[model samples]
Target: MSVIWKGVFPAVTTKFNDNDEMDFAAFDKNIEAQLEAGAKGIIIGGSLGEASVLSDTEKIELLKQTVKTVNKRAYVILNIAEQTTKAALLCAENALKYGADGLMMLPPLRYLADKHETLEYFAAVAKSTPLPIMIYNNPYDYKIEVTLDMFEELSKYENIQAVKESTRDVSNVTRMINKFGDRFKLMTGVDTLALESIFMGAHGWVAGLVDAFPRETVAIFNLAKQGRHEEALKIYRWFLPVLELDIHPKLVQYIKLAETQTGLGTENVRAPRLPLVGEERTRILAIIDNAIANRPELPAGSWGVEA
Candidate 1:
């Protein structure tokens, strides 16, 4: 089935063992938690998944393994952060062969292409693949903004179905809605801003913390979408401190640690990106521990459970 472009889509972390090999068992466990918690889709090999460090062959293997694990229970979307258009197209094409349900793609990796170049890059990729695509519009990390005007140009592509709205400007959600009005499904990419964006009009969340706190993450989206803001806010308030971790430079390590605490995975990261240590590690531990100790009791409803 094609992606509906709605609900929680966890940008899952890539699991690596002590020998620096892909741990498919651990990876499938995390994906299972997300699906059990009602995740609509799974985004593999994203920034949170250490996309920068993963080889293309590794990414394809991850997608293939995830497809085997999911068995069509939820959409399996591969993230493409390639530095060049050709590489991006190749990634998308490989995703197609592995039965990938969709894609969450970033702008050109290291290059800050101008509007025309950026638009053309997206068009070229979108034109190459038949899969539905969600433009990962995160300016803070990538340095290139996918402006509304550029989106206006991108809107012509039938396959460009959504935007991972990470601009952090809540008003941009409103502006996108006013300008395009459901032409694109808007899923907030920032963890802390999720409820705010949802209230404003984002269709779903491309969540980071969900990799660790799958049930809590899905509960917030479900409660809020049902117009249960007060209920969602209670959990969101308790969740704020840990959700803030997603915005940090060492987010992959931080979230992996959270996953470790939850028994979902480990903190093993690729080379050049070692595990956290010192006061920073202690400080992050305190935050994670506090959230775990004082974890909010989820209110009862459609998505309400501590599972």
Candidate 2:
């Protein structure tokens, strides 16, 4: 069964209650909103979702809940960010057991594995599971660049289907296409570069800000895909500032605040990751308020295409 990996797949934040436990009520509500807004899929336990702080059990339960709530309406991809090969394989097995539709995996965390080590780790995990995988290539955050040559070697694995292109270099989009052609599907992982990536033939987006502004995010992708560049630009220009929030260190706090302001979710993040406060909070709120007050009218009728 080929999973159609395309369009906006929000790297959704894991909602927690005041006691630092998973808040299913808020979580389910958020998932419903994403589906209603025409999100192609929902990704849980990603960097945006705070995967590092979550325990293994919490990660599995989150994947299970997402799979049940989404109920085949869209893809539910679990992020595999582990320290060792054994742990990564365990996460992959658990994801398959809990009915995850696919996975988005980062290379060895914190160790900065070299190219050969990275390739070996990925190949081992790919062989261990039958689920489709999207190799995340974000050197800016991970410090490990899965170079084009590394991809050439890993392309032999049939389950390694796509890449989350977060290199921050827009030109890499073209470079990947030039080298691999249609061998690997490219999905823009950076929220700010989404429109440019789509215009450059990227098939999808692993979005961050869409957790709060789903309709606008989907609109930009659809409009550009339909060749409506002027209309897409109008929305993209308005969205750039809000999208910048996703790339920051406090993205979890900032995006959750946006969700609360928009009436979609809450601002209760886990400990050590407190809610945005002080002047920083005021500054972000100002941006969200300005965008909301002057929100652009979306094009009439459905703006999304089926994957």
Candidate 3:
């Protein structure tokens, strides 16, 4: 239970060339944009970063580059979820070697579970690194869920500092906070539920939308932290459309498109994960454009989408 592992950690998308190799320059630029925009940390090689598609060497290089570029301004978290414990250990060791601030891991996929196996999966990964660990509890993405009872047990780990709680159920969040309030730091991963989670006493947001709208993310969290409910609601209303887009599996495509359209990061991504096209592309672009046009008071690129 370390307290250092809390706040708005955006899972940064890894940039790539058309040939599908790691594009270090673009990746660094993306990290810089996020740090400058007020992200508490950069989550390199998470789902948003297409970690599954990345080669082992690419993941190592990306972590190395992230450490070099971030220069310690924010906490650095690396996502190391694989189908095997040995694979997770190897990746976790690599991240720790590069001086990462923490590690986030999901349960081993493809296993039909018993509670015993689930506990083993996490304990094995936690044993791999001394760095603070954030259990990435996204049942929708990983299909392996960690129950609250599981949380009570896992919180006993000296290194298991926080839970990246992506379950959109506010009641579940409330229960976790009420039960494990003093034990684990609960960070919301669902952007649409972020303000609510904070107000409910959850620690912070591990946000995807923060890459596109860091200022708004900061404003929402800051106002809520100060008990300014009405002001926070105002910012949340303006940012809701963009925030709601993150509810989809195609979040990477929409956020990247918004980035390119507004000059935050390149829209290019690795293979096996193609860019948005046709109706998807058109709809995302239009919404971003309309939002920017309506908020002329917010500068060009202030919102990280085209005006």
Best by lDDT: 1
Q: Which digits, one per residue and each the tens of the lDDT, describe model 2 over residues 100-136?
A: 9898999999897888899999999999999999999
Each candidate: RMSD to true structure? 1.7, 1.1, 3.7
**What are the TM-scores, per candidate, against the unseen true structure?**
0.97, 0.98, 0.92
lDDT of 1 by residue, 1-307 (tens): 3688889999999999999999998998999899988898899989899988998889889989999999988889999898899999999889999889999889898887999989989999999888999999989888999998999999999999999999888889999999999999999989999999999989999999999999999999999898888999999999999999999999999999999988899999999999999999999999999999998888776363321
In terms of TM-score, how similar is model 1 to the real structure?
0.97
Give the Å error, residue 265, model 3. Answer: 1.4
Model 2 residue 165 lDDT?
A: 99
Candidate 1 yields a Cα-based lDDT of 0.91
Error of 1 at 245 (Å): 0.3
**What order do candidates take by lDDT, descending?**
1, 2, 3
What C-alpha lDDT, on a 0 to 100 scale, does residue 170 get in candidate 2?
Answer: 91
Count of backbone clashes, every candidate in sequence: 0, 0, 0
Q: What is the lDDT of residue 223 in candidate 1?
A: 90
